[model samples]
Every structure is written in C-alpha cells, then in structure tokens.
Target: MPQSHPASVSSRRILVAVVPPVLAAAAVLATFLSVRDRLPDRMAVHIGGGGHADGFSGQGSFLATALGVLVGDGVLFGALASWIRTNPGVQRVIAVIGGAVAVLTGWLIVAVLLANTDVADASSVTLPGVRAALAFAAAALYAAVGWLVCGKAEEAETVSGPSAGAGRLPLGDFETAGWTRVTGSRVLPVTGALVAATGIVVGFTTGWLPALPLLITGVPMALLTGARVTADRRGITVTPSLAPWPRLNVPLERIAEAGHRTVNPVRDFGGWGYRARPGASGIVLRSGDAISARLTTGSEFVVTVDDAATAAALLNTLADRERRTAAGG
Candidate 1:
C-alpha cells in the first residue's frame, strides 16, 4: 500500500476535525440572515412536547451562543486530531461524531428560526416532532459523509506485532541479549510548564488555594515526561526517566509473544501515561513505534518508545528461552 507523507497526513486529519464545525457555524449564520426579517426579536429556543414555545432567547444571543459552541467544538476536536497520529480509525470516529454534532446543532438553531418565521409571538411557534426527526436524519447523513471523507481504516498490517506471524530474532539456547530505549515527547514537558505557569499566574491574581489543582497537575506531568523502556530476560520494564517509584514490569511468564506496532495515545490507550481499559493497558506517551505484548491471560500490554521492533524481537527471543526452560523443568 502507498504511504501518505507526514505533512499531507497531518493536514488531512486537521481538515477532517475542523471542517464540520465550521460548516455548522456557517449554516447557523446563513439561516439567521435569510429569516431575520420574518423571525420575532425573541425566538423560542426550547419547545414542549405539544410543540409550544416553553423557553426563549434573544435573536443575537442565540446566534452568538450557537456560533461559540460550534467553534469551540471544532477547536477541541482539531487539537485532538493533531495530537493523535497513529490511529486513523480514531480520526474517522472523531470526524464522524464532530460532523454529527455540527449538523444537529445547526439544524436545531435553524428549526427554532424557521418555526418563528412570520410569527408575532414567540410562544405561538410550533416545533413539530417531524422537525426533530429531520434534524437527526440530517445528522446521521452528515456522519456518514464525514466517515467517508475523513480517513481510511485503522493501522495497516505491520511488519511486526503481537501476532503468530511476527518475526523473531535468532538466539542460541544459552545466549543473553537485551534491548533498551529512552523515549520522550518535547510537547509534554512544554505543556506541563505552560500549565504550571498558568497556575502561578492564577495564584498571584486570585488565591493560592484555587491554583493548587493546576500546580499538582503540572508538576508531575513535567517530571514524568520521559520513560526508559527495557526488554530482556526479565521481560519488559518501563520506569520513569528520572524516578523509579512509578514503574511497570511485564514478566516473561506473562507475555505470550512480543512485537512492534503503532499506538495512538488517545485511540488505543485513552491518553498519555498509565492507561487501562478492560483487557488492554499501556504506558502510552505519544503516537508512534510501540512494543505490543500479548499476554497469556488474554490481555495485552503496550508501551510507546523508539526502535520498538528491535525491542519486541528481543523480547520474543527471551520469552522463547523462558518457555523452553519451563518445559524442561
């Protein structure tokens, strides 16, 4: 399969995350412009089951609020997309959801405006169930469209992974070998410092008490930005770059096989640092080369680092040796 250039891939991901919310915001604006003369000064934003107006908001406030929310959603998703590079499935999922949100929100605002068309009293406006159904239908349609445009399927078949066909390093029965790598993200420490700085600014302006949360959040993030990943006779050990207290060790007895695979922090493991969900867990830092370990217990453990293929190969060799010893014993 053809590989996309790094710049092009990043650009496409950003476009997927950004375009939907922008269109939604534009739709709100267009609707407001087209029906401004017909709509009442105050429009019914909330309608009861009977289709009568139950709550109202001023025309300007309603439009401004809708724009703000849509823009904020776009920005949030865009940031998430930029950070997550390893999983296209996650990108498509986010794009589909984002498109759906935009369509639904824009449709709702448009519905309120359309219901108020030529009505003197905001309370006299009717928002039928059909209109709500139409909005959902439109949202679902947009979601489908977004899914098609956003990306291809998830990570392709890699040369190495926790699979039966994964490659292994040749090792003699009594040989000892190991692989180690130190991986860290420049973005994390910078982010931590920025967060800490914001906390300090808050502390000086407001009260020290309110800033503690940010301080607590920032300090550890900065300290634990780097990790040392080791694979050897003992299996895999992940320890913090500067400290040893917070460490993870996957014993040789636990891992059935080891191989390399790409990992997205947000998609596979939820976020950076220690993350666990059901039968899978990882010490995820960022998206890129990662060692994937399939355990005997049917769970999987992953850790992101550089030169992961070599690490995985070594791990597989070590595990094979351990298995032979167990069988002989």
Candidate 2:
C-alpha cells in the first residue's frame, strides 16, 4: 500500500475543511448578482401568520445578512479545522456543518430573491414543496461531505482479545451484577428544546412553515443530550436516555472479547451518540475512557463511560463462562 506523506495529508485536510464555506459564499454572491436587477427595492423580509408582509428590509440589508452568515460560518469552520487537526472525525463533522450552513443560507437567499423578483408582495410568494427539497438536499450534502472528508477507518488493534485471563473477573456461582451510567450534557438538550420551540413559534407567527422542520431536527438533538449504558452478564446495551426505545444491544453470545481504552469521541465516532464510522458503531457521548467489545461477527461496539475497565472485565468473565457452559452442554 502506498503511504501518504504527513504534509500532503495535512494540506488535503485543510483544503477539505476550508473549501465548503468559501464556496457557499461565492455561490451566494453569484446568485445575488444574477438576480440583483430583478429584486424589489424594498423586499418583504418577513411574513406574518396571515401570509402578509410583516417586516421589510432594503436589498442591501438583506444582502448584508446573507454575506455575514457566509463569512461567519467560513471563519468558524476554518478555525475549527485548525484547532481539531488531530481528530479527522471531528474535522469531518466541522466540514459537514459548514457545508450545511452554506447550503441552507444559499438556498434561503435564492428562495427569497426568487420570490421577490418583479413581485410586489413577498407574502404572495409560496414555496409549496421547495423548502422541503432544500432541507433534504442540505442533509444529503452534509452527510456526503462528512463521509468524503473522514475517509475510511484505519485498522487499529481490536480493543480486546480472546484470551480469557486478560482483565477477567473472578467467577462466582450464579452471580449477576450490572453497572449503569448516564452520559449527560447540560447544554445540548436545553439548546435543542429552545431551538425547537423558537422554530415552532416562528412557523406559527410568520407562516414560513419551513421553520416547522426544525422541530423534527431538534428532537434528535435533544435526545442526544444523554446516553444510558448498561453492562450486565447478558452483555452491554446502549440507549439514548431521553428516548430509550431504540437501543444497541451487544449480547454475550456475540461478544468474542472486551476491554477498555482511552478515546476521543470526535476522533473515534465523529461527534457523539450512536455514531458509525467505516468499521464500527458506538455510543460516544464524550471523550475519555471507554469500553469496547469485539464481536464474534468481527464488528466492534464502543461506549464512553466511567469505570470502563470494570465493565470490560465483567463482560469478559461472563462471556467466557457462557462459552464454556455451552461447550460442556
């Protein structure tokens, strides 16, 4: 296999991280120039619930807002790329976020401009399905950017091995115990709820129904505020604490081995809860100590938690006992 030079890789990473927002700005500028002559002198910048113009702004002001968003996002993502150079997963997240922001801003600018072109009232402009399409497109672009920038997962040594003695717990007849931890973040859920509420209010008051989509997007954010992990003799299970129905279960039968290691959530799983990279999926709420289970199927599942070593040890012991019992039967 051909090895990549460190400098070359770094340069590529920089380009990948920095280009999306800049391109977004450029696209916005180009679109504005194309329709500048057609826009009304004073555009209906905001609409009320009755589908009437409730707010107006000059073309320059509108342009400034769009430009500001583009520039601000570019600067933020560019800085993040530099600050998080060691973690490609986080870098990919930053790139995707930048791209999404750019796409959404550009889409909004174009939509508003197209609505106001030669039109006397902005309220008369209705985007029946276009807003949804733009949202979907933005989501698609974000995922694509993350996937492309992050590339493939490297083949790291498995977090655990088949050797029964390594970090194994002592056997006790009919002993069963478990540990549970909640990976909670104070900021994320509150922010998500607030944003969702704001979007709902905006949608109802402005008749810009596009804001209603925020409610759906915000739900995941709020749910991601915390993840609950439980490790017992059966195996390990991870679920979002806020919404626990859908869970990731790693049964003892599937676990070939288990262990704990230090990990960066951004570096390992690309920014939190129920994340999937090329080779593995994990419940990654934060960066630090985590337990990893190497499954018999060859896939790995990880979760960041406190006392990961104990969890791994218990899991290994239980799994070994299960295998031995089955063999004897």
Top lDDT hit: 1
CA deviation > 4 Å runs, candidate 2: 1-10, 13-17, 26-42, 46-61, 76-97, 114-166, 190-214
- For all candidates in order, the CA lDDT equals 0.76, 0.68
Tell me the tens digit of each residue's lDDT in model 2 across 1-329.
Answer: 88665445544555655666677678767877898888778886665655456666788877787678678767876676666555555565666666665666566666666667778665565443556477558757765865565554243323342222338878686887787888766546775787687567545433456576778767667767777888887699888776767888888999888887776665555455567754577777777778878878787778888888888888988898889888994
Candidate 1 residue lDDT tens string, 1-329: 88667557556766766887898888889988999998899877777656677778788887887788789778878877766655555555666666676676677777777888899999888877888788878988877777766656544522233543356889888778888889887767876887698677545422244367779988888777789999989899999898887878999999898877887678665467787655678888888888889889877888889888888888888888889889994
Clashes of 2: 0
| Clash count of each predicted structure | 0, 0
Best by TM-score: 2
TM-score of each: 0.55, 0.72
- Predicted structure 2, TM vs. truth: 0.72
